[model samples]
Target chain A: MMHINDIDTPSVLIDLDRVEANLKRAQDYADMHDLPLRPHVKTHKLPEMAQKQVALGAIGITCQKIGEATAMADGGLTDIFLPYNIIGTSKLDRLVDLHARVTLSVTADSTDTVAGYAARFGAAKPLNVLVECDTGAGRCGVQSPEETVELAQQINDAPGLTFGGLMTYPPRGNIAQADAWLHKAKAALESAGLPPKVISSGGTPDMYRAAEGTATTEYRPGTYIYSDRMQVAFGVGTLDDCALTVKATVVSRPNVNRAVIDSGSKALAADAVPAPYTGYGHLVEYPNAVIIALSEEHAVVDLSACVDKPLIGDTVRVIPNHACVVTNLFDMVYLVRGDTVEREAKITSRGNMR
Target chain B: MMHINDIDTPSVLIDLDRVEANLKRAQDYADMHDLPLRPHVKTHKLPEMAQKQVALGAIGITCQKIGEATAMADGGLTDIFLPYNIIGTSKLDRLVDLHARVTLSVTADSTDTVAGYAARFGAAKPLNVLVECDTGAGRCGVQSPEETVELAQQINDAPGLTFGGLMTYPPRGNIAQADAWLHKAKAALESAGLPPKVISSGGTPDMYRAAEGTATTEYRPGTYIYSDRMQVAFGVGTLDDCALTVKATVVSRPNVNRAVIDSGSKALAADAVPAPYTGYGHLVEYPNAVIIALSEEHAVVDLSACVDKPLIGDTVRVIPNHACVVTNLFDMVYLVRGDTVEREAKITSRGNMR
Candidate 1:
């Protein structure tokens, strides 16, 4: 049993108890609202955690890339969904390989993407394709409900392609608007002689409310398992609920009110704290101290507001503003129950952007 | 004999010719000015590149951590410098191991860090310690010239430490002020019966002006070997001079003015382009296109300004805002000369934060 203190500085430390609690809460919420939780593996790319989520009543796992889906399937996960408009011939070939490994589904917002998928899986088990709707996120998605229906029709018409359903990663805390758009899209699809089998909605900030209406049949929350500072700022959870933190050692105390940590932009990530929140992260031990800025290997902290300043060589845990990006930064993360190390989990799907 | 176009999308492509040119230019500038170049490995993190720099008349390589120094040493690099105030027993032990393998020197801005180094190597080869002076960078360094001299004296008095000299990463384009501060510090150290052996000043933006006066004896530049968008914005180089680029395919063209690429913050990095740089990165093919924002796996590019808009599946090479952080994001980088793939270089010291 390795101790938590024995682990190296600037390592991602995940609390197993907190993770389990978070997992249970989300699953229970989904169960109460009659929604199947298809937890996104993008947050914690470790397939073991995905397996645990599936064991804890999650319907399946959700990946954002073909590589991630393959990693999950290798971990023995039977069902996986990639909710993105995947394009390109090489990627579609890899997607076909991934689909053969598990019950896979992918999202597409355009006919070109559907055509690529159709070309690759022409003779295989029918590839499930979901139409991605915008729903006010203003990212990569179809513009209107009618546009989604047309894309669904394209998927339905394509060889070896099944129109799976609809999915959207809506803006955080705008669940009502997403619900409205999803409702309209569903009605439009129904009128066009196609009803969505699965209406997947995702966003960690609005996860608890995902199953509140008829629009979302399943939820695909990524950051809910290891709630971070961003989630806390969004009122989704409190500081106590944040399970993942980067363990950093104070390498230098340049002045009375300034301390530099080993964790910089590489470990803590460069994701700006989405507003209303200030600073790069929240220090667990010293709540008043702020991570003012980060260079590549140094995190400059402001300690003027803190009642107790950290001395050089002091270890501090920091909840990153965004946890998903932080997971992608490290090769391995240690899982701990309290202060006892459970095991180290490899970030299997890390840097698998292709 | 693979072509550049044959490589996968979102892969790091290193132009060998541009890299060699960038290296030669920096080395020639340093040689003409009589400044020893101690190129920082934090940018490339490859021992092969560090060895190449040493071959090109670099005095040594500068690393940000003990692991990087050890990795460089393993690749047969004999001399290394870590410009960081290292603390903690584990890290100091690693530092001792690193020093045994190479002619190593480290920087300290605090008495605590100096004491830790002294206690660890009391009976071994005397550890070289450079007192880091804050020449208006406002990062991890001693506040004033007096403070730097005091720290140098402390290092000189320590049992197993040699007062190497003064080092600072000054603010870019403010070399005159840094020169004045470094000069005063050197004079103060001389008055205290401790003449500085080496005065090191670093920053790629000021690499050309490193040895204009007697303030610096050596220079440690990280990004000159792979000039990035930020360096270009600082007037260090142009797009043609950049050696590293992320090759990405346009995955989606949501609208006539909006395009999404396979590379995002994960590949290109999320380091905000410091002012006068209004976007995330510089696209080589479509220079006018602005990489306005990035998600984890998607770079949302605004193509409204580009006359030659890239269609879906078209590959574009992007020069990230900061190359150092981007280098750490990938496992392997493909090295190429013109259109032919030379080989792939493993980022040996990547994620060596500890």
Candidate 2:
């Protein structure tokens, strides 16, 4: 085994023990609720880590893109759910090919998307389509219960496609709204002589507050595996549960109150804003130190609180503002156990942004 | 030939014709100045693009990391300059290996970094070291010309290293300060009976404004190849010269004023700060619209001014805030000529961050 110091600076380090602990915690929550846990693999994007989640009794995995699902399928994790609308012929072709190799299900919010998937897969390789309901998170999916039923009915009638379930990712404070939306959509589906067998509803914030009795049979939470500063800010997970961190070296100490690290927007990632984040990222060793600013190659961290300030060569670990985007910034992750690097895993699906 | 529409969404599209034109413009500037042009390959890490620069009469290519330089050397580019401080044992080992493979030169400001490199090289393969004088960039490098000379003397006397030259990335509007510092440093070196050879200077912002008779024989500018929103904000290039743009699909129209694109931080990158600029990125089609915010998977563009509103399935292109960092976000880039897809080239050194 290589020593932790032997790897490289500005590298992504994952504590295997902490990751396992995090996985078990989420698994325990799912077990307690009697909900099928489909851990979203977007957080790690490494096959080895995904396999570990499967070993911890995950039903399968969830992916955001067909490219990621294909990578996971190629890595031998056969069951995958892509909770994003699969649009365009290029992506649909890849989806068709992936469905041939794996048990694949995708989300749809419109008749056009459902019909496109059905036309591509038309009874040849039937795709499982989940009706994505927009409970609160106003990103994608159907707006109302009526639209959900209309899309579900279209999926049921379309050739080579099976309407398997209802899926949604609600806003953090609105679990009740998600439950209400799912209930109405479920009732509408049943009244139309259709039943959703797999009702998947989850986001990291609302996963713990998930209501199982209200048409949700499975939960898909990606960030729960390796919660970040964003999750911590949202009250999703404590700082101790953050499994991955960017180990950076202090490259410049130009002033008494501030220092610059080798990790900048390129290393820590630029997904540092969109509400509660005060700066670029959070310093793991120095929690009080705020990353006041960032350049493409330098991160300006204010280390005014530390009694013994970080010097020009000191190494510090940083938990990025958002973990999922940070995961896509690296090619490999060092799995560390104490002072030893136990393994190096390729971020095989790191840049699969199709 | 793959049609332009056949490519997947959220993928990097490079206008090859525009890229060639940009390259020719930079080459013409270098010729007019009678200075060697070292195009920084950190913008586009593709070997083919680096070769194209070399074919267009660039002296060499500059890389920020040793891993990127090594990849370039492996791909058959012999001359390379690493304009970053090389610290740590793992990086030192790679630098030694790279020096053996190519005509390698690196920048350092501190004696500790220079000594580390010198000790590793050990006279067997003497490494060329350039003293980096801080000309108000406030990032790295020596602050004073006297300090630069002291560091240079240490490198000159070191058994395994040769003091090659002086380099500084001066802040914009402080070109005179850079000139004064380099002049004083050059005088100091000459007084010590050690005349430096390669006086490297120039950043993209100060490329056109580089002062004459500053002993700068070679100028390195990376972003001149594919200018971005920052360049436009800095009044460096027009939108027509931006060779790269993210071809994104309008995935959701949540409200009348805003529309969300599939390209978010993961695709456009989060290095969208630092400038006379506002917003996350610049929309190519709707130039007036502000990219109000960004999530990991979504970019919210405020399109209130456009007479024609974007639909859920409309495709738009975004010129990212920082083009260089954006290039590092993908594994491959599609080279396009007008509406035609020309070729697909691997970003060979995309994640080489050792």
Candidate 3:
């Protein structure tokens, strides 16, 4: 068995213990809420982890693209939900293949996306289409309940598609607001004679505050598997609950004020945490050390305010601002328990940017 | 033969014509300045691209990690420079293997890093160690000219290391300040009976302002090979000069003002350009469309400003904020000219964070 430090610098280390606890906590929360959990595979991008999530009672898995769903299917995942408007002939072709492999569902905010699915798929092997609602998030979703009902009607009318339900990428920390929007859309769809089967919702902090018997029958939380500094800032989890940590070596300690780590945007990723929380990551070793900036391969850290500073050649572990993006940046990650390295997990679905 | 449009959506599309022009322009500029252009391969991560840079009269290629250099060496690159203070034995072991494969030189800012090299390599094959200076960049390097001389002395005194010269990742748009600092360091090194042979300096914006008879012997520019929005904002190039572009399909047009593309933080990356220029990237086809926000796989575009808003299923190309990080996010990219697809180039050196 190898030690955690033995792994290469700038390598992603996942605490198996913390990951298990996080997984259990999320599942337990879902169970208490009486909702089926469909963990998004985009977080880990590992088929093994997705399988583990399913083994712990996840109804299925959520994928963003056909490529990721295909990987998860190949890894023995039977059901997958892609929560994005699947467009183009290339992706639709892959979707057809993935649909044949597993029980697949997709989301659509426009009739253009619904038409693509209807064009290829037939009534014999129908695809479930969820209507994505804005829900005040202002992202890729229909603006009003009327648009949601119209899109759902279009899906219901299509021979190859079924109106699965309503889903929303909501504004952070507002469960009631999302529920209200989805509730209006659900009522609208009900009046249109296309009663939804599953109302999907997610986001870590909001998921915790979700009330029972809401329109949402299921929740899809991706980042909770590896809670990050951003999640901590969002009032979801603490720093100790964060499972993923980037192990970087201090390549340069230029002065008493600053140090540079090998892990920069390329390794740790450049996704900044939602406000109030400054810096790219939380230096676990040096709690007060500020990761002021990041170049492609250099993480410039301000070490002056810290009681202890890292020296050149010293190893430091950093909890990144965002864990999902960080996972995508690495080809493989170490699953560790404290100082012990368990095994290397390949991010098989990484860069599945279809 | 496949059309460029026939390629998958959210794919990294490289305009070969634009790439060739970008390459030639940078090469001509370096030639005019009489500086041996050592193009950093961190931008493209393709060994083929690195070979092209070498063929276009680059002295060599600059890589951040040993993994990247090893990949380049495997692709027939003979000379390599790693502008990083490489620490830890895991990396040092790889360095020894890479040293045997190519002419290798590395940078050091501390004695700890120099000692690691000195312990590994012998006098017969001494490693040329460059003393990295701050020069107000304030990321990684010795703070003053005196510290640079002291580190140079340490490398020179070491049995298996030769004081190669000096290098600095300087502040943007300040070539003179960097040269002046290097001038003082060069003077100090000369007084200490250790005259430097090479004084390397780089930064796209500052590189253009670099004058002849300066202390900088050579310049390392990575993004110039594929000028990004950040480089454009830095006044290095315009949007038309950019070689790399992300082709994404309009999956959702929620309202008259709101549109969503399949490409998001995952595809375009989250590296924000230095001030004034806003949003994730420049929308090429719809120049006025603002990519307001990005989730993992959803680029939220605000299209209110545009007169000709893209309809659903329409494909749009985006020139990302930072091309290097964007390149790292994908495994393969489509090389195209006009509407004709050339071939798929594998980003083989991608995720080489080690």
Candidate 4:
């Protein structure tokens, strides 16, 4: 058996203990709130973890794409929720094939997407279509509660589609506004005799505040599984809760004040946290050291502020700003606890954009 | 046979015509300067494209990591230059194996990296090591020209290591400063009877300014093949010169002012160009329209500036801010000509961080 330190540099390491603890804590919170936990596979992108989530009382797994859902299905996951508008012929065709193999639910904010879903699916094997409401996030969603019901009614009246529920990627700071927006939509949906069975609202920033009495039936927080620096910046989790980290080798000490690591944007990702937090990532070993700049293959770290700096050959663990994007960059991640390497998990759903 | 439009959304499309033209133009510039052109494979990560570049009069290819070089070597590429200080034991072992199969030359800034190379390699099959110098770029490199020669002399004296050359990733918009820096180092090396054989300097921003009558012999430019929005901002090429693009479908039209595409940070990476160029990408069909925000799987477009907006089912081409990082995000790219997809080229070097 190999040890965790024996693994090569610029490798993603997942603390299995933290993962298990994070999973349990989130599941316990959802259980207490009476909301079904649907862990988004985007965090780890490994089907094994998704199955573990299901085993630990998750209702289903949320996949962002058909390819991700297919990967999860291949890994023996049965229920998948794709929280996006499934468009185009090739993608819809794959969705149809995936629908045959698993219980799949998808969301669409427009009638055009609903029509596309209806054209492929029939009443004999109905495809559950959820109306994605904008809420306060202001990305892709129905602008109003009336628009949500209009799209929901279209799905209900369509040949093969069923108005499954409503979903939204809520605002970060003020999630109650999202809950209130969905509450209005849910009332409109109920008035149309189409009360949603699943009202999904998600964001790691407000994972603890997944509304209790409102329309949100399930919570889909992806980053809660592998809490990153971005979640840390939002005050959602601490550095101890961060399950994912990039183990990079200090390849060069360019100057007295600077150290360069092997993990750049290609390994750690280019996602950044908000102000008060600086750099692309935080060095776990040296808390004061900031990863100032990232080239494609090298991260120039500022070590001036640190009392102790890493040598040219020293290895350090870095907590990335965003865990989900970091998972997408690598082909596999090493699952470990302490110094032991448990197993290597393939990032199955990475680059499954279509 | 499949048409380019027949491919799914958020897929990387590389235009063969533009690629060939870009190749010819860059090679022609190199030939005019009497400099050996070695296109870095980081942009495409396709060994096929690297092989094409070699066939188009390129000296060899530049890879950032040993695994990337290994992929190109497996694709029948013989000469590979890794412009990085590779550290650690496992990476060194792989480097030895890769060195055995190809003519490999690597860069080292510190004695620690040289010692690691000397430990694995033998005097019988010596490894060529270049000294990386920090010209104005505040990244990974020796601090001064004196430091460059010191590292070079150390490599020259070390067992089983030959001082190959001097290389620098020059600061953008100022190529002369880099040339002057390398000239000082070359003179110092000559005085010490360790004159360099190959001097390399590269950056897509100043690719056309390959120094002549200076210490620099070969030039490496990664993004010149598939020029991105960043390169365009640097005034290297126009948007039409971009061979690579992401074809994304408009999955949702939430309001009159905003539309959302299926492409996001997952497909088109989160790398942003400097000011004056905003957004994560540039839409070819709607130049005025801005991709205002990006979630993991959705790019929210502000279509208010556009006279014609994309519909729910329309597909649009996007030029990402950094084409190299975008290539790292995908598994394969569709090689296209006109409306037809020529072939699906596997991004062989993607996720080859180790």
TM-score of each: 0.97, 0.92, 0.98, 0.98
Give lDDT tens digits, candidate 1, residues B1-354: 889888888899999899999999999998888889999988898888988899999998899888888888889999888999888878888888888888989999998998888888764589999999888887889999899888988899888999999999998789989999999999999999999999999999878877764689999999999999888888897889999999998877777898888888888888887787888888999989999888888898998888889887789999999999889999889999999999998887777777
Q: Score residue B149 of candidate 2 by CA lDDT.
A: 77
DockQ of each: 0.74, 0.46, 0.86, 0.86
Alpha carbon lDDT of residue B231, candidate 3? Answer: 90
Model 2 clash pairs are A123-A160, A270-B270, B123-B160
Superior by lDDT: candidate 1 or candidate 2: 1
> Could you give candidate 4's per-residue lDDT for residues A215-274 as a string of tens digits?
788989899898999999998879999999999999999889999999999998898798
lDDT by residue for model 1 (A54-159), tens: 9999999899888888888888999999987777767877887787778989988777888888877764589999988878776788878989888889888887
TM-score of chain A of each: 0.97, 0.96, 0.97, 0.98
Model 4 over residues B1-354: C-alpha lDDT tens digits? 899778888899999999999999999988888899888999888888988999989998999998888888999999999999888877888999999999999999998999889888989999999999899899988988788778888898888999998988988887778888888888998998889999898878888876543667999999999999999998988999999999999988989989899898888888878789999899999999999888899999998899998899999999999999999999999999989998898887799887
Give the TM-score (vs. native) of candidate 4. Answer: 0.98
Candidates 2 and 4 compared by DockQ, better number: 4
Top candidate on DockQ is 4
* lDDT tens per residue, model 2, B219-325: 88888888888887777778898999899988766557777788878898867545667887777778778887776677878888777777777788888888888
Off by over 4 Å in 4: none
The order by descending DockQ is 4, 3, 1, 2
For model 4, give the TM-score of chain B.
0.98
Native contacts conserved, per model: 0.72, 0.42, 0.94, 0.93
**Which parts of model 2 are misplaced by more than 4 Å?**
A123-125, A212-215, A252-259, A273-277, A311-313, B187-196, B212-216, B252-259, B273-278, B288-290, B310-314
In model 4 chain B, which range of ten residues has the least summed lDDT? B207-216
